[model samples]
Target chain A: MSPFVLDDRLERDSEFVTALGLCQLRLLKDSRWPWLMLVPQRAGKTEIFELTPLDQAMLTFEANLVAGALKQVTGAKKINVGALGNIVSQLHVHVVARHEGDPNWPGPIWGFGTAVPYDNDRKHAFLTALNEAIGS
Target chain B: MSPFVLDDRLERDSEFVTALGLCQLRLLKDSRWPWLMLVPQRAGKTEIFELTPLDQAMLTFEANLVAGALKQVTGAKKINVGALGNIVSQLHVHVVARHEGDPNWPGPIWGFGTAVPYDNDRKHAFLTALNEAIGS
Candidate 1:
């Protein structure tokens, strides 16, 4: 197994959630929507296609698992799964639980309204529920 | 081999480019940015996790291939890949090429501005060059 080192951008933008089997689940500090970013624990990897065939299957499985958990917790109207390496060139997947009437409804949630950092109580509650939902 | 039936939204929203062995490539008709959508031919699928292990690997391969082609042809500053089935339930992956000074710039492109439809000549040139770039 390759030792995974997270990029600085991801580190700065997110708070630690927990570790999954194949990826690190980080809570995006934005608190805009119930967003979770899954970065596969592979060093120097920046794209999904870089994974081996078996690893591709694993990442897809993990992404689905994480996204489903987020959707259930948030009752999201939709879930947006994206790997855009525009700012951060890390191979991380954003599994965002989209709610209706959100600040940027029916749009991609990147670089939208100022991200509100999660308050202490709200963050604790959300993380606890997320951990339960993800069965981690 | 399964015959691919395009979802109505895909048909209306994109123009066909070419096909890799595992997926079809289409340019997202929103002239807002150089974007491509990859849809695997498996009928009635609505999510990436729903794909078989083999199909998942194949889709990943094809998505990267198409993304690379788009990036080269457009000289995009970044590439955004996503599979969000919010409005349309069909399984489609978006590979968008982001420029530095695009209208949305650092923001997500969804719902930012009205998509400028590609005129005939422009669309034709883009399609032809994309096809060539992908070595189709």
Candidate 2:
């Protein structure tokens, strides 16, 4: 795999917001909750270790920055940050903003229910707000 | 605060293991179900991004190593790997081995039960096996 190829599907996805730091910040395809994904610009990167030390710092700082923005935009009760490399091998960290009484309360978010895709307007609006918060 | 200074009692009291590459391996003071922590050592670390790219990769590699060792050592049905900075404001990741019928079964592990300090023999056995598995 080339080191810098961006998956076309991932690039065209409307759910993600392109951050000023050049990382693709996408909301998870699921709408069961307010979940966001931060995919660093580097390609062919299945693991966090694939990037250089400086890039690692960028991802980590971006994760925190994105998490804070999501909290402000969504007003969630708890924020869950994880990079479970079980399914999608891409190096993406999930910043899920969990609210009280969310589906599958007090349980793992996986395998709870089918993900509900966002409406066109809602998705666009979310992307805009996230970008604004990220100051992108 | 100095970049490497950790103020939490757990952070202060943790026993540094020979499992350097196997992640930050530490026996929970309260030995409820062979709990272990895997904190990747990186300075100026606030989130995963604070890590240099190389350190980030090393953290994941070490995290997987500890995850495998924890399963073998504890026979846990669920292995929880998370970096929640709500309590300890560091970039350390937790690799907790959990069982289905455990005290916090099918629920969050936080505030589930009082911590049970590890007995001497068990503590010795756990760390010994972990070190052997890590082989340094």
Please report the candidate that would top DockQ against the real structure. Answer: 1
Candidate 1, Cα interface RMSD: 1.9
Weakest lDDT window of 10 consecutive positions for candidate 1 chain B:
B104-113
What TM-scores do the predictions have? 0.84, 0.60
Candidate 1 Cα errors over 4 Å, as ranges: A1-4, A51-55, B1-5, B20-22, B42-44, B119-122
- Could you give candidate 1's per-residue lDDT for residues B1-136 as a string of tens digits? 6666899888998877787887888888788898888888888787676688778778877887787788788988778899877778778998988989887776666667677888889888988888898888
The local distance difference test score of each candidate is 0.82, 0.66
Q: After superposition, how far is residue A101 of candidate 2 from its true place, in Å?
A: 15
Candidate 2, position A55, lDDT: 79
What TM-score is obtained by chain A of candidate 2? 0.83
Which regions of candidate 2 fall more than 4 Å away from where they truly are?
A1-34, A37-79, A83-94, A97-123, A129-136, B1-3, B19-23
Backbone steric clashes in candidate 1, count: 0
Every model: Cα RMSD to truth = 3.2, 6.8
True contacts kept of 1: 0.66
Poorest stretch of ten by lDDT in candidate 2 chain A: A5-14
